[model samples]
Target chain A: MKVGFVTPRYGPEIMGGAESAARMLAEHLQARDGVEVEVFTTCALDHLTWKDELPPGVGELNGVRVRRFPSRAGRSAAFYGLDGRLRLAPREASLQEAERWVQLNGPVVPALVDALTRSDLDVVCFYPYLYYPTVRAIGRVPMPAVLHPAAHDEPALYLPVFGRTFASADALCYHTEAERRLVQQVYPETAATPQLVLGLGVATPPPARRPGGEVLGLGDRPYLVSVGRVDEHKGSVMLARFFAAYKERHPGPLALALVGPVAAEVPAHSDVVVTGVLDEQDKRDVVADALVAVSPSALESFSLVVLEAWTLGVPVMVNGTCGPTREHCEHAGGGLWFTSYEEFEVGLERLLADPGLRRTLGQAGRAYVDRHYRWPVLIDRYLAFLEGVLARGKGRRGSSERADQLARGRRAQALA
Target chain B: MVEERLVAEPEGDHAQELVRRVMAEVHQEAARRRVEGGLQASELAELDELFARHAPVGAKGQRLADVLRHVDARSFVDPVVPVASKKAGGSALKRSIRSATQWYVGFVAHQVSQFAAAVSRALHVVDGELQAIHRELELVAPGPAPVLDLAGTHRVDGWWVAPVLAALDGVPGRVLHGGCGDGWLVEALGQRGCDAYGVDPRVDERTSRVDVRAEDVAEHLRGLAPASLGGVVLSGVLDGMAPAQRHQALEAALAALEEGGLLAIQAATPAAWDRPEAPGEVDLAPGRPLRTVGWEALCRRLEVAAEVREGPAGMDLLVLARARGQGAR
Candidate 1:
């Protein structure tokens, strides 16, 4: 069966959560028997600008066919202002204002949308539920569309636009049960859609015992490491403030290591170390040697880094506010979660003071990753879901015609 | 099964109303089709048998059931029996009188049968209306809790744990099984990799779990800070509490719960509450168990969303959470 993927950004260099998930799913599906996989995405690597980087049109990436479309415009300050207003009061926004919001949200590729709407693929999967390419294209497409919403409890998801988008899809795939519940809470009708909680699969990292502190230029000191973009949204600011307070209160020998893209201001502290983007090997080593890997993001669908930490047999600390992270911790029993400074201090103290506890948690995490998130297991579920879509598609022969009628009606209404 | 909050305005309410309207339209269409199909199989069979007994030549000479299939059962007629003798031995007036009496009896019987058919149709329509009303009421106010007797069996199977854990992800703390009757739920949670403990006003020595303690729920909740506890399960505990006490417990549970922490309330159906003979914990409560409507109203008043699900055995589970922006409505 031929399957296609629609995403905002596509490429090996793109490190965004949805982008990475799309890539892994595509690759895994491509490797399967009797499954033909392809990807349709924008010719841009950066999410902020949506600028044209790769040449537009057809190409190949990692043995899968790729079709890239150039965006008409990049994002701007005007877009942010409009988005902020729209998010605050979406119900009040006029049709014209809603259209403008989508336009300015960038990666506004007419060609990609046209392809998605016109494609005859057996199944087209749209990743995450943000961005113009997904939000706009999903409604217009007449195929058996599957949405992997990667939903979190956030303001943007509650916007009026997503309800229609969710309704238009034939099925939904979720990374976690919490994400599924969030989707159901926002759009109750989506509960009727065929949904499966098939989390994105990650490969087990090769065992490398290289000294992490020496490779990442950090001195031999017990520390808590967070591997992701150092942004306020990812709870970097909160972690920084808490670490500073903890350091001042106890004067401990431990440090806070922030690794990944430096997108936010890092709190100035003598013990805090900011490593901006490490190579794959260095990242593995750092996670393996860290006292405890921390995921502070509250808006995560699934923290891939947490799984990576578990794969490397390391204990983790996650923000309890993030459903997916906390769920992973709860189900795996491989980590602890902290909601406040007090909780954070206690969890940190326990992991730091007791080596046995850390080992037990880390081992449990490794077992969970191996048992549930193996690539083969995920691929099998993916195939079954697609087949189910095909079986359900039999009764949906007139849906395309119905979709066309609805589109025409909407266009006529918009013009008037 | 999950209880989801219906969003306000921006067409959220309109969407639900529209769905209900469409469903009513679909139902009307189905009923219309059924009516157009004439008599159903059972009615047709009865009419065919009636014809077979009366029309001997037609019934015996041909396939009577097959012939009757094309005929409307309601319009089928029984053949008039030849009763009066035509011999001119006695008085001609006597034969005439006998024929008139026979005709009168047949006419009276036909009228009564027709009247019965009309009443049946009217009764069917009334029954349909009653069912529709019941369905609407069920949607607005959750139907009575199922009659589940959890008094004797303290089986703490973690069936409700998945949804509760999903709701409790926002807070970081041990799960508090508020009315930990038999310590089974708390033990199940601990086995499922959660830091959980039970609290109750009374404790049983035969309980298998060791984390439970004898403590009042209100007292335990007062000591916790806002958004401190991850989840609090009120399994049949709220039913026994006074209305004001229950209200206060709800306030504390909401306060102690993080933005998305779970407040799981499981209870028996109204049948248990109404039945004096039924031996159950729900019967011990002074007031009625909370229905879907009251449950939703309470959540709305507290500025939270409650999702409710009813089980087969009259057990209802309510999962509650605080909405975004904290009281945006």
Candidate 2:
């Protein structure tokens, strides 16, 4: 099967979960002998010249074909970056400028229509429905489109336009039960239907080489670590308060390390060691050395960092506010939950004081991840799910005979 | 060693001991019968009186025990007995057996019932205690509610502002409505038209769809994106959270919003009409009314948020969103 994947961003510049997932799906799908995969995404890199010119149509990355379409760079900029005009100077810009930006860049519909019409593909999978290109493109094309609405919140776009695209899609894929419920709640009409719950896979890290590392801030001690974008929603402030309370009760040499992109506004704290965006190896090191890794965010679809921490045999402490995080803890059996500051402090104190508990939880978490979240297992599941969707689509089209012939031809081609 | 010290301890002392033991056994049996006989006699008396009043005159006078045995036998013969004389006869028969058993068994059955009741009550208590422990574990556990992605979207049924506002009045702190799509409810409540602003992750200026990721509500709020809203309205966000994520979302909302602001929330009441095996999709269970015990338990643990009101329509129209030490408005 020749499959086409639609995403907001692609390749070396890809950031965020949906983009990473899209890339992974494309690569894995392409690796299958009887399948061909292509990725379609936005081409504008710099926000300033987004309006200047449309970029080239096609490029190749990691043995997969990637097609880049011209989208309003300024709009993309405003949406992606914090310093975009729409974000920083919303009050200063005139209504006309805003309207102009909306008009010029809002034509993702045309771009998507053009792309779908031009390409001859059997199945098209779109990622992160909130993006204009994916939503607009999927809306126009009537083919067997598989939508991976990465988060429930993104459905705000599809809810108004397609009126629950997941329900109408040939097949819908979700990461967690919590996310699936959110979508169902919004679109109650789609209840009791089979939807694929394909969870994200975690790569098992190589064994930890170093015995331990110094706690960066508290001078020669281990520390509890949190990795994510250092934003308020990620629970950095809540964590800060928790750490402070934890320090007062248990004055151990252990420190608290906050690693990730620091938001513009962070709570003023002395003990926190904020390392802004470390390399992959450094991140793995931090995870390995940390006494515990914490996720304070209340709104995660599924946290990759939590799984990564688990893969590294590091115990996690997740905020009880988010469903996916809690599910991770439960399934992984490697974390603790806290609803209040006092409770958080108590949990942290216990974990910090007892190394044995940490080791047990961490080992359990690693084993759980290895069992359930490996990529090879996930890839096979994905293939089976896609095949089922394709078969169902073919049934709907009343083209079983044609589908069989195509399958035979593809098999023959693979053999050749 | 002392010859003749006991001076003729009774000659037949062993025989007397055997006789006493036999007498004691008889006394115990008599006592047991007395208790059992008393109840059985009263039951028979009642049955006799009832028969005299209700049974046809000159009919064979049947003992209550016999009537009860007939009823038990009839029940197996016809499981779904008609509510006619026949059914009544069967019922009366069962009642007669119960009465006769009470009379014949005496206090044994009563004691057994009492013991069973006590055990049942203890088991219930233990179950409740275990549930409480689990709730505590859930509360103290870190992370947010699990996010359940719904398959579709539905328009909210109606506007519920007064009760929600009343609940918010009790919470003395700033509030944020995570996933405030289109700012409809916020604008309706005069939050957005006034000082309240929304921070959606999507960041679209023209439309209300802010692409705020589920995990990023706190991040946007903390950036002072909405600045300072007196109250946050998380209308349907809670239902979307996993048990853990729900806690995290609640904490994040409380943390980012003003200390004394209100958190006016409206969550779904799981549709009562849903069928069993409702798949892995969204169901009406999450929005059900908080049972008395469940509500109280939640209130006790969530010191920052209190359950101001909850009902069948709106599972919980809570108002107490202010944390302790955050003074009242």
Candidate 3:
């Protein structure tokens, strides 16, 4: 079976979470047996400016065919003012205004949408809901359309047009059950659509070498690591302030490493280390050797770093208000959450003092990953769901199911 | 060494232990800080957190009524919509459309408005009556009865288990054993080819062999699908309960059983409570044992087809009742 992905941008170098996840998924699907993959995206790389960098045409990257189209117009500067004014009364905005909001949130790749609508792929998957290609082509595409909303609780999510975007898709792919519930709560009319909480599968990395803290340029002092883009939007500033206060209260060699690509300036403090944009191996090493891996972002729809930390048998701490991160903690029973400074101090102290608790939490978290998020299990579920989608559009697909009754009978007799 | 071994074992629930302990400490500390006006949360956030748990019962019904009132108030169609528009001649076009459709829309809105108001008023009366009954119960009735550990305090025999197995023989649905500590009876029932499970607050899910849930017996029964169970057995839950709580458990058990289902009950006799040296649980229990005659009277009042049997030594009593309906054999 053949599958296609329609994303705003597609590449290995892009660090935007949603687009990076789409690239990874496309690559993984291309590697599988009997499943071909293609990508239809734009020539833009920089999301802030939306300038055309890559040559616009067909190319092959990692065995998947990619087609790039140039934007008719980069987002005009005038749209920002209109966006700020319309967001205040988003729900009451007129149809023309809402569509304009999506256009301004742009790389208005009209050719990409047009080319995808004419493609012969069995099913098409839209990486994210907020884009020009998706908002225009989702309903018009004749084949079954699967929307990977990657939605967050933000102002754009409430714009009246997104309601139509979510409702028009044949099925939805959510990062977490919490994300599914959040989307359903916003668009109650789409509750009946077929959906799957298919969180991105984490590819098992080879054993990470145990490097000391100096690998991240910090000495061999006990440290905690927080991953992802370090910016105000990602809560890096608050984390730095909280760490500064924690260091002042308990003066010691305990260091806090903010390890990722840095967007905003983190306040320079004695105990904090900001290692911006490490290689993948170094990133894994930093997460692997830490006392705890922390996800402080409150607006995440999916935090793959948490699962990556768990895959290496490390516990995590996250903001309690983030639905997806908190759900990972609750489901695995491997982490703690803190909404205030005092709770953070107390929680860190608890995790630091108890070696056995840390070990058990790490073990439990790895077991959760093994049981659900392993690639084989995820691949099977993904294929089966896609098959079901194809079957829904035409007729039933191939028989890939075991006779469950036979398995049940064997289980009963074995127990007997 | 033993504690270290338990802690180091991956099977041990260290995550649950640590989370419970640290959360308890953090809650206590946060509360103290809030009382001292030192909490860092915004006043609005604190107020929201403060009142999250303070809502009275039946507040949901009252909230529904309030929402209906708002809908009713807004149901009227306004013929005089604002003619302000952004496009050239847009204001004039909107005025013309409003004038053309005003009377038709207003006539339909009048009927919808009256219907919404009627629903709002009817809901208001129901909520008021429910609140009154709740207040009356609070004033007149005794507080909920306390549960005592009869399983640890007293010895029970398998005399009733055989009869229960026979009565529930060929039963069509699953069986539940209330107060099934260690789940010995439920396991035995399952071994006999009976689909059986148990509910006991003390049963550890990791160690128990049977499908025993750590929940209150009555609360578990209330969550079951109506007429889903083939049989239900109560042994120690009725040992020390107020009359109201006892009736509540009985009603829940009967409601969960299908037609022609078995309802087995066993309790210690009042004379059996003479053991003042049983445990502090018995000594401090809020209610005492019920007599066998009282059990018979309860069965009679509920119109249940029941048999009252005295244990061989007069130390225990058993009541076996069948939830019989007109169509049931």
* Candidate 3, A1-416: lDDT as tens digits: 88999998889878888898888888877888999998999999888767899999999999999999999877779779988888666767886898988888788988888898799989999989988988888877778888899987666777877766776777677778667656765664343344566677787866777584868777688999999999877777767776776677789888988988889888899888998888888888888889998887777888888888988888888876678887777667778876556667667887888877777777777776776677666666677667756755721111111112222322343474
The DockQ value obtained for model 3 is 0.06
What does candidate 1's lDDT look like per residue over B223-318, in tens digits?
A: 444443567777766654555666777877765554456678776456545655555535434456666677777777777777777554454445
The per-model DockQ list reads: 0.01, 0.01, 0.06
Task: List, residue by residue over A1-416, the lDDT tens digit for candidate 1.
Answer: 98999998988898889889999999989998898888999889888899999999899999899999999887866989988788666656775776777678777888888988788788889987877887787767767888889777765676666666766677778888668656765564453355567787868797786888877677687777899999877788778777876676679678888999999897699988898899888889888899999997777888899999989889888876677887787667778776445456657776788788688778778877886688988888778767766655622212444334333433443474
For each candidate, give its TM-score against the true structure.
0.57, 0.49, 0.59
Best candidate according to TM-score? 3
lDDT of 2 at A390: 65
Give the clash count for each candidate: 6, 89, 0
Compute the interface RMSD for candidate 2.
Answer: 33.4
Candidate 2 lDDT over B1-329, as tens digits, reads: 11111112132233224323433443355345434643344332432232222111111222333333223222221122233335647767766666666554656655665665565556556667876887899776543322221212212334355555555554432234554554444444343222233433322221222111223453443333111235676644555444555565555455434445666555544431132432333332233223345534655666654655454353333334444322321
**Cα shift from native, residue B44, model 1 (Å):** 81
**Per-residue alpha-carbon lDDT of candidate 3 for residues B1-329, written as tens digits (9 for 90 to 100):** 00112112243255556666766786567556545654343532322232222121112113453333334434444445788999999999999998998888777776776776677678778878877888898877654343344333222345666777788887756688887776677767766777666766554432333455545665666544345467888876777766777877887677667788889887777766666545555554456777878898887777787898877767667799988732342
* Model 2 lDDT per residue over A330-375, tens place: 5456777654443455466666777776776777677766756677
The reply for model 3, stretches above 4 Å from the true place, is A394-416, B1-21, B34-329
